[model samples]
Target: RTVTLYAPASGIVLEKKVMQGQAITAGEELYTIADLSDVWVDAPLREADAGVVATGTSAILDFNSYPGHPFSGRVSYVYPTLGEQSRTVRARITVPNPNRLLKPGMYATVRLNTSAQSALAVPQSAVVQTGDRAIVFIDVGSGRLVPRAVTVGRSGSDYVEVLTGLKGGDRVVTSAQFLIDSESNLGEAMGAMSGMGTSPQGKK
Candidate 1:
C-alpha cells in the first residue's frame, strides 16, 4: 500500500525534514515551504527620520545583484521598538517578486520618500561636529570664515536641515572646512594667551 501526502499550500520547498522512506509517524515533520510571490524587506530608519516614515510610504530598494534595477514597494509595517545599538527604527517594506529574483537575506539599499517642505539646508560636508556641538563655517566677508554653531534637524543623503544659526542666503564653506576650523581654534587660543599676558595696569 502506498500513501501520498500533499502540502497545505503551494510554494517552493525551502527545507526538507523527512527523507524517502524515513518518516513513519502519522504527524511527522516533513518539509518547509515558503511562498516567494512577495517578500518583506526590513529597512533601518534613522532616529531623526522616524517621524517622517509611516505606513503606506513609498520605498525604493536597490540590490547589488541587479545593479541599476530598482524595486518599488510600500511601507507595510513599522516596528514599534527601536534598535538600541543602531538607534534606528525598523520599517517593513513589502515588495512584489513575481519572478522570484529577490531572495531572502539579500542586502539592499532602501530609500524612502517623505513629504517635502521648504527649509534652510546646507551641504552635509559643511557641518563639522566637535564632539558636542555642530558648527558651520560662514563666509563673513573680507576672506573671513567664521565658525557658527547650528542646530541641525533632519538629514538627507547630501544636505542636512539647519534649524537655527543660518539664513537663506548664507554662504557656507563646504570644502576644506576641517583645516579652516582648526586654524580658527588655534587663533582663538593665541588671542586668549595674549590677553593673559597683559596684567592689570593699576596693579602692575
Candidate 2:
C-alpha cells in the first residue's frame, strides 16, 4: 500500500525533522510547520512590571519594520515561571494575523497599559537596593544625607511608587544617590562602633 504524508498546516517547512527513507513511527514529527494565522508575541516583563500586569490586559505593539502601524492585542497567557537569568515573567499576547502581515520572528515592543492610581512616588534611580531591602537617601539638612528604609509598590522606567516609610515635602537625593548611601552607611557604622566603645561592657 502507498501512503502520503502531509503537513499539518499549509505553510513553509521550517525544519525537516525526519530524513528520506528513514524509519518513522506513528504520530512522529516529520516536518515543522510555520502557521501564520495567529501570531504570538512572547515578551518578557520585568518582575516589578509583571506584578501589575494581569491576564487579559490590553497591549499596544509597535514593530520596527511596520513603522507607523501599530497592532493591538490582549495577553492570552502568563507563564508561571520567571526567567532564570533575566528574572522576567513571560507573557503571551495573541495577535490576529488574518492579513498575514505580522510574522512570528518579527521584533516588537509591547506596551502594557496597567491600571493607575495616586501614590507617593520618586525617581527610580534615586532608590538604592541592598539585598531584598530598598534604601533611599533623604536630604535632611544642608549637605547632609540620611538613609531611610522604604517599601516600594510598583516601579516604572523613570519613577517608582513608594508604598510606605516616606512622607510628602521630603527632599530625596536623586542624583549621586549611591555615593550618599555609602556615606550614610559609613557614618552609621562609625557611630555604632563609637557607642559600643563607650558602653559599660567595654570596661569589662
Candidate 3:
C-alpha cells in the first residue's frame, strides 16, 4: 500500500522536517511553508517616539541587500509591551514583496513619517552629548564660539528638539565642534595658569 501527501497551501518550502523514506508516523510534522507575496518588517521605536506612531503611519525601509533603494510600507500593528532591556516598542510594518527581494532575516532600517508639528529644533550634528548633559557651540561674534549646555526633548533622524538654552535665529556650530571645544578648554586653562603666576601686587 502507498500514501500520498500534499501541502495545504502553495508557498516556498522554508523548512523540510522529513526526507524520503525517513518518516512513517501519523500526524508528524513534515515541512514549513511561507508565502512571500507580502511580508512584515519589525521595527523598534524609542519610548519617547512611540506616541506619534499609529496604524496608518507611513514607513520607509532600506535593506542592506539593496543599497540606496527604499521600500514603502505602513504601520500595521504595534506591540503592547515595551522591551524591558531595549526600552523600545515593537511596531509591525506591512510591505509588499512582489519580487521576493526582501528575504527573511534580512536587516533593515526603518523611518516612520508621523504627523508634522512646529517646534524649535536643530540638526543632530549640532549637539554633542557629554556624560549627563548636551552641549552646542554658539557663534558669538568675531569668530568666537561659546559652548552652552542645553536641555533636549524628543529626537528624530536628522534633528533634535531644543527645549532650552537656545533661541530662534541662533547660529550653531554643526561641524568641527569638538576641535572648537578643545581649543576653548585649552584657552581657559592657559588663562588660569597665567593668573596664578601674578602676585597680589600685580607682580610676577
In order, what lDDT does every prediction score? 0.79, 0.76, 0.78
- Write one digit per residue (lDDT tens) for candidate 2, span 1-204: 558977666976668988778888998888878877778999998886787777899899998889889999989999999888998999999887788898667899999887876789999887877679787767666455566779987777799989888999998877534453455544552343344321111110
Give each model's clash number. 0, 0, 0
lDDT of 1 by residue, 12-64 (tens): 88898877878478887788888999999999988878888999999899998
Candidate 2's TM-score: 0.76
Off by over 4 Å in 3: 24-27, 125-151, 163-204
TM-score of each: 0.76, 0.76, 0.66
Models ranked on lDDT:
1, 3, 2
Name the best candidate (by lDDT).
1
Model 2 misplaced regions, further than 4 Å: 6-12, 17-25, 178-204
Better of 1 and 3 by TM-score: 1
Model 3 residue pairs with clashes: none
lDDT of 3 at 3: 86
Rank candidates by TM-score, best first.
1, 2, 3
Predicted candidate 1, C-alpha RMSD: 6.8
| Lowest lDDT block of 10, candidate 3 | 195-204
